[model samples]
Target chain A: MTIGSQVKQSLANMKAIHATLQQLALTSTNEEAQRAFHEAMLETEQMIAALKGRISTLEREEPQYKGM
Target chain B: MPAWLEVAIRSICILIGLFIITKLLGKKQLSKLSFFEYIVGITIGDIAGTMSMDLDIRLTEGVTSILIWALFPVAISHISLRSKKFRDFVEGNSTVFIKNGKILEDNLKKEKYTADELLEQLRKKDVFRVADVEFATLEANGDLSILLKRDKQPLTIGDIKPYVPEEKEPQTVIMDGKILDEPLATARLNRGWLKQQLDQMGVAIENVFLAQVDSYGQLTVDLYDDRIQLPEPQQKQLLLASMKKAEADFELFSLQTNDAEAKQMYEQQAKHMQQLIQKLQPFLM
Candidate 1:
């Protein structure tokens, strides 16, 4: 509902996608598919880290939105 | 010219004429032919046969007759294209044989289609039960098109609301021990990649009978020697299973977590993961 909650929801989805991609990377027999999934997982991890930073900045700017 | 030589020349001439006429007529004759087109075809063949053997009829006369027969059909088709009424008249209207799960005996009699014939056509379509058919029609091309009852219809992608990834046509990268460069390029792969894959599989290029690269980038090979077996590709299945397991783990985490926020996040993530699995199911399965 709130911007913080929205961000948290997005973060959750990103984490799930990342986990799925990591699983695929580990389990895939095809070399190209494995490499692709691994790369996508790394990219998603960076995005998750970036989103976490955004959430921290939001928390500092709007204290009411923090821990909500 | 000798008598035998004359007949040989005539036959060759008729054969060439038939080829040219058929080419000019286009692919319409290759598909279902209308009754008129069928009659014209038989007449042309008869004329060609007579002209080839019977020296009494001049070759020019036979050619003229065949040309008239071919031209009239072409002209009729061109006219039929411009006029819906004329097209219906020329091709004949598609007759309905069944409606609302009921066989129309009057329509069947009009089309002179016997019950056995109708049953045979339905069987060819793999529909054994006439009760399952909601509507059936005899197309102008003589094809029996049938629609099964709503409850009898097979499940399709639309029935299940899942996001299905579009699949590209697979490329035949190898055939008869020869690597096709064009198809490999179409598949966005190179000879080096193919060689490496073949090497990994312990299969030589020369020993491969056929090989295809699917949308998932999985290469499947049929070997010249049928005795040897290659392991089936299971990357899709493995990926799907892993995703399912991850989804189950998230659900379990949601159940076990004490913090309300963490529990909510896990539940939402599990739901999202389930959606992703649904999206990928069509391709993976």
Candidate 2:
């Protein structure tokens, strides 16, 4: 697959992980677990944002990859 | 020397010799002994027992026999380690009795194991149905190692992918009313912290029979007085519940709001909070 598609796939995986972490945080009864999950989710969100930015940059530089 | 005195001296000498020989033999003798080791152990024990009571056998001769018996096995084991063929000869090869859920009658006959005996062994392993067994082997030590079919296998933690926090062993800070300083240090806690915790609970350190600190730094104490019921720790649970309530409120705010920007912000916060809760589920739960 192209670099764009690979990056998109990674981005998708990160989002899924973030969603799972969020779900765990909501469902967890332990305070420590909830805190840990919330912290991890925030970190994952930052990574997702970073990936999104990279995708935008890639699309701008290579117009052919845009909307792929 | 009196005959009784001579007998006492001989028994003491034999006891020391037996202790030294057992020490040289290593811990394997204490655990599952191979067939060869079992026979060697029995022979040495019988010789020691005879040498202890019987005044006829000289101490020197008995000691020499025990030494040879003990050292020969040690030498054989060392040699077996270097040679696979020798190892197989000394520790007999394990026989496969069942393959692909079918018992091999020929192998069973070769091992002189009856169909009834195989079923009995299988039953001992909690495998009632022979058809459920995918692979079964009779170990050299007479242990039946059985592997169930894929469908019959129990589900493990690996089957479901979830974030599980690594837990450190609970440190026993107090045992029998005495504070263990080393364990407290290992748990990264000091006496002041422990004192404060005890004081908060209104439990005297002397009254506590056992106290353990878990990975979450929650101190659990058992008092000598069984009638006194200490409240269970619920701080973490309460905090998690409050966080969930906040997340719910955010969702409600997002739904009730008319302003597009305000609604979007509230929705984003709710989503973020939800993700945070999901991440903490394993540890908190």
Model 2 bad stretches (over 4 Å): A1-68, B160-168, B253-263
lDDT of each: 0.80, 0.80
Best by TM-score: 2
lDDT of 1 at B44: 84
Query: What TM-score results for chain B in every one of the models?
Result: 0.80, 0.85
Per-prediction share of native contacts kept: 0.00, 0.11
Candidate 1 per-residue lDDT, tens place, B53-117, comes to: 99989877888888899899999989988999999888999999999999999999998999999
The CAPRI category of model 2 is incorrect
Clashes of 2: 20
**In candidate 1, residue B190 scores what lDDT?**
84
RMSD in Å for candidate 2, one decimal?
Answer: 12.3
**Tens-digit lDDT track of model 2 for A42-66:** 8767657755765786688788988
Residue-level lDDT of model 2, residues B30-51, one tens digit each, is 7655988998999999999998
